[model samples]
Target: MSDAPTTTESNPYLRDPDVQLMLRAKAGDDAAFSELVANYQSRLVSILSNLVYSQETAEDLAQDVFMRIYRSKNGYQPTAKFSTWMFRIANNLASNARRSAGRRKEVQMAGGDSSGVQTGNAGEYLVKEKSALMPARQLDKSEMQGIVLSAMEGLNERQKMAVLLHKFEDMSYADIAETMELTVPAVKSLLTRARENLRTQLESYFK
Candidate 1:
């Protein structure tokens, strides 16, 4: 079947066929590749922006991530949805970024994170509940963004990945497992622990 997705359609977002686009990318479709980039670049930027904190650094890191994706296109496999696989790569890159910073502090001096911004009487976890309702429900975009990033910074890398892909992206357990290379049960366990920890971090906000 040629293993390539034909990009006859101008806006794949209307089609929303990521798997098709990825297959096309695997088959060396530059237009398909550009479509993939256009669809995910902003999302990648938002995620990395929160993790890295510096806008400039996030941009560079995002570019590197896409470069990695480009490099990996030849070997791309559709084990999970394109989004899940992409986020797995993203989570890995973000963690490496933290490590590469060489700023190891005993969880006591996690700077620039600021433990997230409090919008109101809601605790950190509670604020998340509200943010989850709608992108433009009752909060400003920047405020919601800060909360998401700060909350993520506090989570363990694995937990953060699980939460980000699931809570933010609404991925399924099966998909998350495949993307993270964990068993389905393992992803569930990770989510459970992640929720608990976030709730704890958020408890202070409510208090």
Candidate 2:
């Protein structure tokens, strides 16, 4: 009943993974670079979409990320994980975009709720929030989504980035700290507070 092509959860580069590919790519293996792009393109786009709305802008930024990677291949070291490095660049680009522009409004199919992600309705129930969020009312799927995004939007720049990377990008505290140029404990504390704040804001609706 669907026309979409089936996608497999395969990454051929996993044998050598991203870092190895980058090394070969630096040695002028065009195929290796292409493989790296194929491996990470989806993740890059998904991460960017969480921050920006325009697909065009996301594509441009994604290309720039890769370009920087290629340019820096000679000096690159695997001190941090490949993903951490990739997202560090992504976070920088995203932060700069936010500073230069206003909020981007677009429906995101990534990171809001998937794979144990909280839902607006609990266990297949359709609950609707009262008009204007009247006290003690329920929240539907869209309302819940809006509430999460809005609550996240209100966080200070660093907190927002912390939440986005931790909760959505699934980065570790160490990786996040490295990306944001913060201490590990600081990243942990920030995420703990961000989660608590979001939970407090959405508790009534969630239950």
Candidate 3:
């Protein structure tokens, strides 16, 4: 869906060992498929946990991602890195889950959850505390993390995802663009805005 120029050089992923493993799995190698699953299981869960804000739901979604990949293995190609393809699926799955959750109009918010993400209800409380947080230097590590999480909660879903992918995953603009189905310029703009929002939300902490 990106309007940006697509890469014309041979995809670097074609030489990736993981892509080769996936190709083997595509050829009906069950063990190869299992290896791929094992390799990505933890990573998928980690990313999805941040996206959905629930460890349990993240695990379920990760399983769903693998299932979809397995079912579509027949059509698999090495046009991109295995990780890129995997995260693209994760990003889409997370977006769909958010939309579905939004339709219900009621979401439970739990504090001190294993996942650092905050749900809609959680964010409701955060808006009330926007006056100011204690200075960042005085807070402990846990408190700082909470502040960051609270700041992240203020971002809209797309901005949050863009921040997570760019900051946590260390993905390039092009990589993030591919994963989120946005143009490179859009991805850049999203991250810029997200960072500004984060700074504004955490202004007290930064000082």
lDDT of each: 0.67, 0.66, 0.74
Q: What is candidate 3's lDDT per residue for 144-193, written digit by digit as tens?
A: 66677778878888888788777777889998888888999999899999
Kindly list the per-residue Cα lDDT of model 2 for residues 63-88, writing each as its tens digit.
98999888887666555557777888
Cα deviation at 61, candidate 2, in Å, is 1.6
lDDT of 1 by residue, 122-169 (tens): 144334444554456556754654554566567776777777677656
Give all TM-scores, in the order shown: 0.64, 0.67, 0.77
Which segments of model 2 are wrong by more than 4 Å? Answer: 1-16, 102-143
* Weakest lDDT window of 10 consecutive positions for candidate 2: 117-126
Runs of candidate 1 with Cα error greater than 4 angstroms are 1-16, 103-152, 204-207
- Positional deviation of 155 in candidate 3, in angstroms? 0.9
User: Which residue pairs in candidate 1 collide?
Assistant: 5-24, 123-206
- Model 3 TM: 0.77
- Global Cα lDDT for candidate 3: 0.74
Q: Lowest summed-lDDT stretch of 10 residues in model 3?
A: 1-10
